[model samples]
Every structure is written in structure tokens, then in C-alpha cells.
Target: MYVPPAFKDDEVESIRATICSAGVANLVTATADGPIATPLPLFLDETEGEHGVLYGHLAKANPQWRSAPTGEALAIFMGPEAYVTPSWYATKQETGKVVPTWNYITVHAYGPVEFFQEPERLLEVVTRLTNIHEKSRAKPWAVSDAPAGFIASLLRGIIGVRIPVTRFEGKRKMSQNRPEADRIGVAAGLAACEKPQDREMASLIPIPA
Candidate 1:
């Protein structure tokens, strides 16, 4: 993705945090037929490689997985985002030259892809993924929550994915290009928004009022 220096996010820890917080992402692959993408919930093993490895699953019937990817696959993780109106800029009052923009955080990871059907590994992946999302629930579900036969049958209908992220790019465009006064105005406007995501993005702006 094209990113200006002012908006570039090069901090490895911060980038990893953004990916983790995103929870779900779009995994894209190019095939002889065309490009295919699937939205997936993934787990990252940061210790695995330079940028770390991503693990997830897709439906066994999803044709996207059957087609061999010609090149590296891409995973996009998007975080908090908020709208910035011209009115939310000091320049709009001073010179009326400000334009509307958006403040958001995102990460793009690219790597070679591998798909597997190992039942034991699939079982482990499913269990950890389930625990990650269900830990917050009062009554969390588990892979063993179902009958042995039923769980085994269900696992047969899915495939596991492992991609070692060779490249990681992160972008955090939170009004860093704006003047201090404009940044403050935008943050305040977003904080006042009724949307929880907008409010969350407002809090992420590094430039404080």
C-alpha cells in the first residue's frame, strides 16, 4: 500500500499489536483463474519467522483454497478509523483550505502460503483459535464441546493455513500530517461522535490536544 512518511507506522511492536487487535482480516491470493479472497480469523506465531507466521482455516469446499496461489499471499488487517470533516480543522477557519480526510490504522502482511489437512494440527489450531475469541464469554465453547464423532466430522470439512509473513507494513494515519490545532479539533470531533469506533480512533491519535 502507498503510504507517506508522515503516516507510516514502522514500529514492529505497534504493528503486531494492530494485527492482533484487528482479530479478523482478508486473505488474498492470486491464481491462474484470477484473484480470490476470504475473510478469516487468524492467529499469529510471532516467534516463528522474521515477521512471524499466520495461521487460519477456510472451508474445505472453498475453491479459493483448491487453486494454487502463483505468488505470495496478502493479509490485510484494519483497525480503528474515523472521518474527519473540513470543519474539524483549524485551517478551515483560518484559510478554508482544508479538505476532508480519514484517520485509520492498518497492516498488510505478505508471505508464501501453505494449506494443510493434518487432523492433529488442525485440531490444535481450532482449539487455540476458539479459545482466543471465546475467552471473554461467560460460557466459552471448546473443540471438545461437541461429541467426538461430530467434532471429527466437522474438522473434515475445513482446511488449515500457514503463511510465513515475509513482509509487514503498517500505516497509522491519525492526523499526523495536520497542524496541532487541526489535529486537536479532529480528535475532539471524533471523540464526540456517537459511534464507538470513531471514539476509539479519536483516542488513538498520538498528537494530544
Candidate 2:
């Protein structure tokens, strides 16, 4: 990612928060045949390694898991994002020099990938993942809700994945590079828009100290 100095996000805690909030990520791997990717919901085991470990599952029929990745795999997480029109900038009225831009947050995690088929590991991973997404619901479900034989059969159709994160690159582009007046205009414009993401981006616009 080409992040300018003004937009770089270096805080580890903030990065972790963004990843969790994203809920889904694009997992990419390069193989002898070509590059392939999958959109997956991953769980972060923050206690496992220096930067924490990522766990997920893929369909057994997905060839990406069976192919040997040539190098480190990448997981991309995206957060709130919205389009910024030139009309949102005060500079457009003052000097007519501003152009359209985008405001967003994202994180990239890279590490060696491991694929496993151990039933016990798969069961544990699926249980934890289910709990994470279901905890907020009024009637949360559990793996135990299914019959043991049925659950085992379901697990057999998927392969477990683990990636010990070796590094993370995070970026937050929220009009930090704009002048105070222009940024304020952007915030006000986004806040008044009907789109949920636009309103969310409005809250992230940086205020001058």
C-alpha cells in the first residue's frame, strides 16, 4: 500500500481494532499456476504470537489451499470508506484547485500460511469463530446445537488455516492532508449525506490541534 506520511497508521492497537471491525478479509496467495484469492471471515488469536495469529477455514474443494504458496500470504482488511466530491472542499470555492478524493481505513497482514486437516483443530477454530460473530445476537447459536456425527461430517468438507502474522501495514486516509477549512467542509458534507459510510467517515475526519 502507498501510504503517505500524513496518512500512515502505526498504532498496533488501532490496527487490531480495524481488523476485527472489518469482519471479513481477502486472503491472497501466489502459486505456480497463478495468484488466487478468497474472501473469508477470519478470527484473530491475539494471545498466540508477537503480532497474534489468524485462523480461518476454506472449502476442501478450494484449490488455493491445496496449492503450495510461493511466498508469504497476504490478508487485506478494509474499514469505513466513502467518496469525497470536490464540492466538499472549501478550496474549490476559494482557488478551484482541489480535486475529488477518497477517505478510508485498511490493514494488510502478511505471514507464512499453513493448511491443516486435524478434526480437533478444525472443531476448535469453528467453535471460537462462531462464538465471536454470534455473541451480539439475542439467540446465539453454538456448534453443540448440531449432532456430533453431522458436525463431524460438515467439518470434513472444510480445511483449517492458520497464519502467524509476521508484519502489519495499516493506513488511515481521512482528509488529514487537507486544510482545516476544507476538512471541516468535508466533515459537514459527509455528515449530512444519507449513506451510512459517509456519515461514519465524517466522524473520523481529523480535527486540528
Candidate 3:
């Protein structure tokens, strides 16, 4: 991910938090034909492995899963991000050396990928994933809410994916390389932005404890 030392975020909990907040991830695989990617919602089981295990599903007709991956798979999780303009840097006024950059959080997880379509396992995966995303709703839904026959028929149209994470590399480039004054300016500028995502990034900027 080309993370500089100043921008590296190695905290395990922090990385997990980012992954969960992402809700969906980009799953990439290298195949004999070429690289293929799928964007889908995934849930992490932190207790399953030394690192953790990721679970998700894709349409059964998606060719990306039909072909065997030739190498390790990568799941990319992205968090809040915002554009940082030179105008937000105090250094711009002092030395006119600052340039535009992106401030964001990302986590890359690598592991062997496995694709399966067993109906029982597929049902379990679907139920758990639904719970994770629906738990916060005022009127939460459940896999059992649908007729069993209907749900079974629907499961046949998708395939489940599992990845036992081997390692994780996370980066949080939140204006950490800038001076304290410059960082404060960036935070203030982001907080005042019209985009809600910019305000979310503002809350992540490190302020003096």
C-alpha cells in the first residue's frame, strides 16, 4: 500500500475497526487469464484464526469465482477519506510548499481464498452477514423471515467465499506528516466541509492529548 512510517497504522484493533466500518470490500484475485475483482459485503470472524477469517458471497454466475485463483487473494477495506487542499495547510502560507493530497484509512488483508456452495454453509453465512448489517435498524430483518423454500431457492443463486487471513497491512494517512499547526488547519477545514465523509475524517485526525 506504499505506506510511509509516519502514515502506518499497525494496531490490530484499529485495523479490525476499519474493516467492520467498511461494510463492503473489494476482493481481488489473480487468475491465469488476468486479475479479477468483486465488490461485496463481508463479515470478519476475529476468533477463527491467528489473524482472522473473512466471509462473503458473490453471485454464482460471477466468473471471478468460477476460475481458480492462481495466487493469494486480497480484500481491500476503505474508511473515511477527504481531499486535502494546499489552502488547508498552514505551511502553504509560510513556505508555499504544500500540495494537495488525500487523507484516508485503508486496510489490505491477504489470504488464501476458498469458494463453496454447500446449501447449509451458505445459509449460515447469509444469516450471519444479514445480522451484522441489519442489527442497527429499527425494524431489523432476518433470514427466517422469508419462506424456507424461497430462501433455499435464493441461496442456490450465490456462492459463499471464505478467506483465512494470513496478514493485514493498514494505512491511515490523516495528515500525520504535516506540522501540528498544519494538521490542525486541515482538521478545521475538513470539519467545515459540506461532505459528511470529510467531517468523519476530521474526527480521526490526531490532536494533542
Candidate 4:
């Protein structure tokens, strides 16, 4: 997460928004064997500690949970991103010095990792995670919808994960380093793209007053 000063995003609200909107994260840890990572759907509880707390689960068979991490774990959350062509830069025509780059929003959260197997805690985690993702559905599903025995049996195959986030490094590389005219051109170009993600990224580019 090497972020230049121009692209740094230190605002708490902005960082939190990126994390929440991401819906999923890459959890990485260093082990004696090597580094291990798992893509997980994680939730942030902003009310928890100084920074926040992250919650998720992993399959019981996954070795990542069993390995002892040498240091802090990292959770990487990625937001909208798009490829910026040098052709979109006004400087390209003036001096032909511009090069292609990627514009994206990302957050790296670091903290101690905890894995638990208690059935009660696992059930609570599963129920909350399910509700969060299902709330937008027309007829939302719930853990209670399934039989207790069935849900209990399923929970046995998974382990819970908790991380009390100690720090956050957020970056928003959205053409902020470009000149006003170049940034406008990028925004226009991306907005006209057929990809919805490119169009979404267009709105994040800063426009000069």
C-alpha cells in the first residue's frame, strides 16, 4: 500500500465508506511456512475499538486459520477502479509525457487476528453476516429460516474470525495528480465508457471549480 501524498485518503468517513462498500476483503497473514491469504466477506463494526473491529469466517478445513501469524494480519478492501489511458490526458497532446495509470480506492487495515470455534459465537457471527447481506432483498432470508439442527451442523464446518483494527491506510487514486483540463478529459472519457464501473469511477475524479 505505497500511497503518494497526492493520493492519500486519511479521512475516517471516506475510509469507512470504502470498506463498507467493498463487501469483501483479502485477509493476509505471515506464517513460518509462508504468507497465506483468503478472500473473505468481512464486516466492520465501527463502534468497537479505536479504529474498528473486523468480523468474518473461514472454512474449518482452511489452513490459514490454523497457522500462527508471525505479526499483524492485513485486510485489504478494494473499491471502484478503472484504467486511465494516456490519450485521455490533455498533456499527452501538449507534451506527450503522460503515461497510463490505474485509478482506484483501497484500504489496508492491520490488526491482531483471532480465530474462534465456540458454537454460540459462530452462530451469532453467521446470523449477523447473513442479515447484513440479505437486508436489501425483497424477501430477506435468515438463519432462523433453517432448522436449528441443520444450522448448527453447518456452523461446525466453519470458524469465526475477529480483528480489532489497529490502523488503516487508505488510498484514493482518482486523477488528483492531473491538471484540471486533463482530469476533465479523463472524467469525460470514463463517463462515456460502456462499462458501468468506468462510469462509476468518472464521478470520483476531482473537477476544478
Scored by lDDT, the top model is: 4
lDDT of 1 at 135: 92
Q: Please provide, for model 3 over 63-89, each residue's C-alpha lDDT reduced to its tens digit, 9 standing for 90 to 100.
A: 998888998999999999899998988
Error of 2 at 16 (Å): 0.6
lDDT of each: 0.90, 0.94, 0.94, 0.96
Supply candidate 2's per-residue lDDT for 90.
Answer: 86
When 1 and 3 are scored with lDDT, the better candidate is 3
**lDDT tens readout by residue for model 2, 1-209:** 89899999989999999998988999999999999999999978999999999999999999999899999999999999999999988899889998899899999999999999999999999999999999999999999999999999999999999999999999999999999998999999999999998999999998754
Number of backbone collisions per candidate, in order? 0, 0, 0, 0
| lDDT value, candidate 4, whole model | 0.96
Global Cα lDDT for candidate 3? 0.94
**Taking the tens digit of each residue's C-alpha lDDT, what string does model 4 give over 1-209?**
89999999999999999998997899999999999999999999988999999999999999999999999999999999999999999999999998999999999999999999999999999998999999999999999999999999999999999999999999999999899999999999999999999999999999965
How much is 21 displaced in model 4, in angstroms? 0.6
Q: Which runs in model 4 stand beyond 4 Å of their true positions? A: none
The TM-score ranking, best first, is 3, 4, 2, 1
| Candidate 2 steric clashes | 0
Give me the displacement of residue 200 in model 4, in angstroms: 0.3
Model 1 misplaced regions, further than 4 Å:
none
